[model samples]
Target: MSSTVVETRRVFEVKNLDVYYGDTRALRDVTMDILEGQITALIGPSGCGKSTLLRCFNRTNDLIPGAEVKGELNYRGQKLYGKEVNPIVVRRRIGMVFQQPNPFPKSIFDNVAYGLRVNGIRDRLNERVETALKDVGLWDEVKDNLKKLGTSLSGGQKQRLCIARAIALQPDVILMDEPCSALDPISTKRIEDLMNNLKEKYTIVIVTHNMQQASRVADYTAFFNAEALDNGGRVGYLVEVDTTEKMFHDATDERTRDYISGRFG
Candidate 1:
């Protein structure tokens, strides 16, 4: 940890957050703060609500049928769940990358320019596309082939293109759900490095099962665990949230240690 004191901005404040799908609770009472310009990793077993909570930040949960979110979720001090909140606007401000690299079928240049065009940002469109691609370190490889289909790239490049799509909107935050889970080791490293660089400009929250990936890239980590239900099911809840150092070394919760130690999921 750095000894120097630094001021931090809170981008999202989640209080007693609970999520349900058709009256069944998936996550309960999740309260955590997402700080700006930092990568916060959400790690836990499957069905532990990491992805569920990640989607909540951008209101993607609203897309699912019968999905319900209760309790308080605030973005930049504004009530995120307020009646006046616009899910579309919320999504534009908080972009997301899904587990699989799901690039649009458009050409490389068009893919990066998609969001900008939607937002009526015709001015400097070329510059924005180039910058977003360069930000993800994809321009050098694909600059000459800008018309190539985004899906034609390798898995890693496709993922990078997807990232370029997200950042092109100049989003305040990026939510990645197991971004590197589908790539090879070399490709994973590239995404990890890209993530480390991205935190300087955009706040990031990622849900990943790879403990090493979380440890290597995240500045903060939130470990979630599930409790057994009477129906032989499990529901996830936040177990611990702390700096990466504290989470990996001296987590306050025994369940967190158990999960970290490989004693249980």
Candidate 2:
């Protein structure tokens, strides 16, 4: 008797997704499944819609004027773009950490507690804040400096603070857009290690131009590229997606192979 291993549950199911800003198409027909409790990386060149696609996961695109999205995006089998869905609620469940560490100009503790306060969660607030900080490996460093301003921390600390802020909400999925782009190599490695550890509790999707970074921390990878449209503008689209090992060593698509091999982005 042969027993088949079941695949992990999918967290996000995107089908033929297209995103537009005004008349310009930013991303076209992107379809992918994000598995639960794994790190999925989006790697591509500039103007290739990696970040645009990440925004679609939490409906952050809706905040931009004239931004339109076409096609289906489901979160845990529910329609993410459904009229009945609330963007605020969606964001709460799908947290985001941007390229820059934009911690609020508040105390370190307050930064992590902001979401809890907004959600009206007062019970065990201190405990929650501490746990969040510890989860991101920042508790020991900032435990005594809880009252200090978040912006006063180093670049690496600031990014971890932002991460603590997100994880404090206990979101099921975390979207990161070039999270380590501005940090030193040591800082970048710290973030990558945190990502590896965090995957046990949360599904992560990251947009990165650093091929090595993607290869280091991602379980799955999606490659995207821009094409010149008939209107003379470039529109980004998915090229290939596969297990990180497969994508790096044996991608079926020539474009994916070339991009991963340093021939072209």
RMSD of each: 2.0, 2.3
Off by over 4 Å in 2: 1-6
Candidate 1 achieves a global lDDT of 0.93
Off by over 4 Å in 1: 1-6
Clashes of 2: 0
List clashing residue pairs in candidate 2. none
lDDT of 2 by residue, 1-265 (tens): 0011046888888899999999898999998888888899999889999999999999999999999999999999999999999999999999999999999999999999999999999999999999999999999998998999999999999999999999999999999999999999999999999999999999999999999999999989999999988988899999988889989999989999998899996
Model 1 per-residue lDDT tens digits across residues 78-133: 99989999999999999999899998899999999999999888999999999999
Model 1: what TM-score? 0.97
Error of 1 at 13 (Å): 0.5
